[model samples]
Target chain A: MTAPAPPSVAGARSLVEPVLRDAVARLDPLTARVAGYHLGWSDPYGRPATPGGKALRPALAILSARAAGADVGSCLPAAAAVELVHAFSLLHDDIMDGDRVRRHRPSAWTVFGRSAAMLAGDALLVLAGELLLEQGTRGGVWAARGLAAATQRLIAGQASDLEFEGRPEVSLEECRRMSADKTGSLLACSCSIGAMVAEGPAHLVAALAAFGAQAGLAFQLADDLLGIWGAPEVTGKPVLADLRARKKSLPVVAAITSGTTAGERLAKLLAQPDPLSEPELAEAARLVEEAGGRAWAEAEAEHRLDAAERQLAALDLPRGVREEFGEIIRFIASRDH
Target chain B: MTAPAPPSVAGARSLVEPVLRDAVARLDPLTARVAGYHLGWSDPYGRPATPGGKALRPALAILSARAAGADVGSCLPAAAAVELVHAFSLLHDDIMDGDRVRRHRPSAWTVFGRSAAMLAGDALLVLAGELLLEQGTRGGVWAARGLAAATQRLIAGQASDLEFEGRPEVSLEECRRMSADKTGSLLACSCSIGAMVAEGPAHLVAALAAFGAQAGLAFQLADDLLGIWGAPEVTGKPVLADLRARKKSLPVVAAITSGTTAGERLAKLLAQPDPLSEPELAEAARLVEEAGGRAWAEAEAEHRLDAAERQLAALDLPRGVREEFGEIIRFIASRDH
Candidate 1:
């Protein structure tokens, strides 16, 4: 059984949802409808539906602000901005990746058509900046710069990820760098932008950013593990989804670069032009295990988690705030979906 | 042939090009390459090439600042930011509209692939806000807000344009609003954002914005006319390109809703499934003119230009700045390509 979610996650969601909805409401009607559906605030017909995703990035943003001794109200805009950026990235990435499903539903591009969905994503991105700048403070400008820089890195990482699909071989280092860029940059920004917006000390913001960067890598490693071994119901995707697509995810790259006979055999299986059968997929999974890819990913996640903990330990944050961050770290390491 | 071109246009291009290049160079190599090609600064392979387009938006921005009594250097960032946003929209719009060519060359998506071009557009958008916020002034924050709002409206307008393609009927009012949102919003923002960044008086900013809105509508009207009658050697697009695609451009919509027998014939022709033959396309263009669409568009453009002129006439400005504005207005009204 999974542990209960940290209280900060639920609290952050309640605070950020209204702000996010208000910003989206400012979009044109059709674009707003597309965005509403994508955010899981409603079905395609505009009827209310349960919201999707864990709101983890906004939680991190609010927690960062709290750790900096700022009121929750002061961080709401930053938290919402980060979440909006996350939504924008997912909307565009789904189109590029041709992934038809998101949060167990049809992707926005599939439902609203590619052009409308693309415009909706663009609207959200513009709104994210508008929300931040409307705060009318120096800190708001600083946070906006941080978010923009992170977004550029995120786009670059995605470009590399797509390029990897055409390449026959990818180095483990390149794969790691791609993951850091695609996933870690935004997470690190989310962790520190709220503090920057709160006028927190530079050292504290740096420490929080470092902690988040490590945690984000661990989160990505766990995600790669799930892509190969996750339950379809839990992950909202087919079993061995990454392997089925022959995606150059971290574990697959690690196994291919591992110098063992099993690694070489696994690479050959993936290199074949035809689709892999069920038995072949299972065999490939075994070969990856034999080559120590799974073990390496798991150990790497643990090491990163340890490093994240060290970052917090070096800071003189309030005891309660530190404990809340520790809870989030544990949640990241243990999440199954 | 083009009235020797406006000196302000050349001056603005020279001043803004360096700042624009500096911002784009900050992107990842792949994205930066795509942006360079889209901006006409380089060929697809990154070799230097002659720059394309008139840099009209940046010129309007610089002129706005000058009219507000500020030095051009103080407005450079805002000028570059507006131009970057313009480039960003073109890159994405080319993809959305399935237009394979721009400025006499292959569109960015066609050259770099759609996914890379999309990411490059996304990168330029983020960079636009970054450039503004980096100014570290209250006016910078104001300018960013203005840009963000304009971009949202622009996206919304594009969304409506795409929606119009799927519908059989669209009112002239709907079409006008779409044009205002899609094209007018950005132009108006470009006209005023520079003055805003310079902390110009509220009255001057308002006057510049009004002039830009009227001129922007005039610009779109001219564009619509060119799409039907423009020479391939000049416009870099085939003759009757909009009619070939059955696009519901302002002229086509105006003709269809004109209530003339010719309008009915044009509508029926566009509704047919098969592509229009050359003869049929020419016949359709003739019908649009017979239905008064061409004359209507030309007269409306003149009307808007007159309105734009009155805006400047009411303002107190230096002779040279006013003359430059008048030159651009005349250029807009008389240009054939």
Candidate 2:
């Protein structure tokens, strides 16, 4: 029997090869190579690798369609488009964040250097539109518009994140706004594009969007938790990793606004030296937990997850469709890393 | 006294407003605002500015259309798209180049910051697709495919530019290829898009593309000259600024390949401590010119400009259109900045 399956990021790795096989079939050799390289489909020496990524978002797009009684065939363009945007953001974001590793390998920028990585990202973004247009979908206009708007929201969310780095007094409302714009928009875009292909009912589209947005907020909250209290073995970094970086994450913002002793201690710890000693970082994490920041965030994630599930339940889908939607919702909210 | 003549950039600037005003009326307000900001129609602070930019490329597109007997009416959408792509490239290029000013004001990133500037650029790029798709002259598939291909070529050109920046040795052939992909592709697209609208003769369309390409190559070479030797008071940078940046301009590349003593001196000068004393910098420029680098570039520019004119002259057109095209040709080749 298979060992209790690892996280879907592991299980989903197997599916990437099939997805890429389909994608590369459409591109010329050069573009396929470039696209493959950009997606971490190649090894450190740039040889083709076990094709990478969880295919998590693309799976959402396809699953949402099937769950909504729509043919997944029509949603393929949207899936590819969303995945391309995701890869574009990841490449550029690594540069901005100075992230050194991705998929247990050197980041694109680290491998090829910064500018090529940026260009590869640019190429991926441009290729998404090319893919959509090539499909000659009747809904091509809406697809382009949908993807463009989602991309803009992605930038807006990223801008807020960068901007918040310097602001010690950011509000809880501001953190929520940032998370919603950054994560929620893309998730909502996935569902909307899925429903769009189905020509699903307008109310159904609205419900899916709401459900996706809620799921996304839960995902982000969970990520913030992992960034703070997560174990090094699990997270690939020391505990209180966000604290070491002085990241103005959801928990940090919650602490600051709650006016608790832990808030004061956390802020003091953040004010200290380079990569704060692990002990110092742990002190800050303890403060965050004692001040109820963890509980607050956990409750919020639960509320949103439940809200998302409720919206999913409202849809009159067949049992098979409903079960798939339920699994995607659970995966989105609970997945680690 | 005779009226003062309009500036070339100003002459190009004048045609942009009416055309943009018409094109954006169909889009949502937020998108239109973003487009306006990118065109420098809005201030760096994001207020509306006068229709800015030398409408050089779009005017060329319209003139080419008329010469090819396409309705000027039909050319407007394509012109807007071509101009938007041009503006998008300039926005991002300024950030990557660390350029702080544009059109006598702060660059977009200087005012909007990098991510916003980047998003603003991305928005314009995407808006261009939306514009072309809506052009409806050709279907969405054709327009999107053409624009996406052009964008990839443009990004590749940019990548080559960035790649060359730190290289100690770069061939002149490499420089020309970069300039062609970077600058020539857009101009070719402008002419090709006009052809699409004009239903221009296939031979004429092909000729227009060749004319635009040669003209674009010449334009970049001339611009490179201006970057090095033109009066900063006129061009908005210090004289020999490209020399100051140690850029791999055509002249410098030619000099390096020539293997002359002065070329060696120029190369050593580029390797000199930055913040090089002004006199030493001036002496370095003299060495480059004395080595025949500047002259080599000027001759190359002349060759391409001549080829561009011959292409246009061969295009069968009404006498009035031919005369206008000639005036535009002279204007493009002779501009100082």
Candidate 3:
């Protein structure tokens, strides 16, 4: 249905998995167990489980390195580092958000205690920096710097998101900035880090970073849509989960600021003190669609995707590499989970 | 008292505070405000406050660099990074431990909220790595790697500390190992990272690290003693704070494992469910002393100080530098708070 995914997706996972596991193994036993569980590498009892996560960030890193004309293995540390940062952010975010589910399973804080999950997140973050520094090259240092900057932005984005929850008035522009920082920073870093690690030309690295930034925004729009309307089975989340949480996601923000009767109704519903009932959530969803929020998000995502594609097209990469990047971008735009 | 505080302590603080402030300024405004408050540079309202914290780790870093024959200013980044890491750990630990007060004021989480404090801590951690990597030197990479390893051990130590809270029978050796990981690892890194960043010889770095490890254990022993009997005004903590939390600090663990009648009584008293009353806490402190926990801890601190001194004496350094290191070690061993 989605062109079967680019080969680089699976290839990146295979190459980066061992490195990730090894880095996690370096944590203390209890932390390793918690981290391993959160990463979907094992069950609560430490037995193997189906590996979880899309490994999308690492795939982007690997593809960026490939575009730089480096061997696939050249950017392994960078790839692993990006994924580790992503994992770290998710673990902490779940605890802060009080979300009990992640990747279709009980979140780490729900499985392990909050303190343990928090420590595991800290361990992963430290391990990411260690992994990159262990490369012992200037490129490694450069990549580590990039990753750290991105992580800071990601944290700021999350902070803003939490702040938005308590505020009644969140402009769509503010929501978009939050999405860019929360998701786009790491994605852009992931795209450029591999090329940076491979000593790619400056122009190529910048182009890839720009492309990833646009794609990341597109990816966030799709995710926000899923948060509201995605099936529970496909998205590994409850129906209308965002609306239930009163999350000021892009569509919700767009609707709240739409200046229409349906938008006004939706805002009033979200402003209520009690949690929304199932029927109310359904009505809220309908109102968001009726207010043109859903259509706006869809159009914005498409626009971003086109911009991402143009950036990739202008790059002087091999055809296969370009096609691989294109396929991953499209996959992200259409992913159900 | 205790040879009048070492000039290097004040000197290090002066040298590193600006750099530390600069690094924290890079964070988003809200996180930066939280971090600033936690660092004692500002009040909850963002107004300037009297500076807090002893800046001992940064002093160690600066002194270690001096010991390596590098200019005192050369290790500012390493010193600032170590201090940032320490602040990061304290911020998160306060949240995890539910501590309401820190450095004689409300903890960051209490002043702001848990989520904001956590994000601030996360921001600081990322900024620490970024500072080191920004140096763009091979030594910077090496120091970042060392800091990362120490951070992992520190997290492991914290995990063990939390785990020990529920377990009734924690062996003395296990508790000691936990202390080494929790406190010794970072202290050791702080002592050695300066030299590592200055490209000092391996032997010098190793000696500095060993000295720091020994001093760190001694420092923890002293801190555990203070937790039981130190003046609340001086310690900026409630009387018998650790006991109130049922923390398995070294002294408490020693008393519990002492195999004396007093130790048995202390254990029974601790095993009760509700919060310990003030009188009960006082009684428990007396029992710990009667059970020889206090004496044993004092002697162990002395023993560790001797080892630390021997390591420093063997190093090829100027007399003034040696005196400075000696003064700090002595201060650590004798400090009441």
Q: Which of the two, 2 or 3, has more DockQ?
A: 3
Report every candidate's CA lDDT. 0.89, 0.71, 0.90
DockQ by candidate, in order: 0.84, 0.34, 0.82
Q: Runs in model 2 with CA error above 4 Å? A: A1-38, A49-52, A64-77, A103-106, A194-207, A258-280, A316-319, B1-52, B61-78, B100-113, B134-141, B166-168, B194-207, B258-291, B314-325
lDDT of candidate 1 over B238-278, digit per residue (tens) = 89998998888888889999999999999999999898999
Please tell me the TM-score of chain A for candidate 1: 0.97
Report the number of backbone clashes for model 1.
0
lDDT of 2 by residue, A87-160 (tens): 88887777777777665566777767765666666777887777666656555555666677777677667777
Considering only chain B, report the TM-score of each candidate against the true chain B.
0.97, 0.89, 0.97
Tens-digit lDDT string for candidate 1 (A192-257): 888989989989988999998898899889889988988877678889988998889888889999
Error of 2 at B88 (Å): 3.1
Evaluated on CA atoms against the true complex, candidate 1 attains a DockQ of: 0.84
Q: Choose 1 or 2, whichever is better by DockQ.
A: 1
Ranking, lDDT, top scorer first: 3, 1, 2
Error of 1 at A310 (Å): 1.2
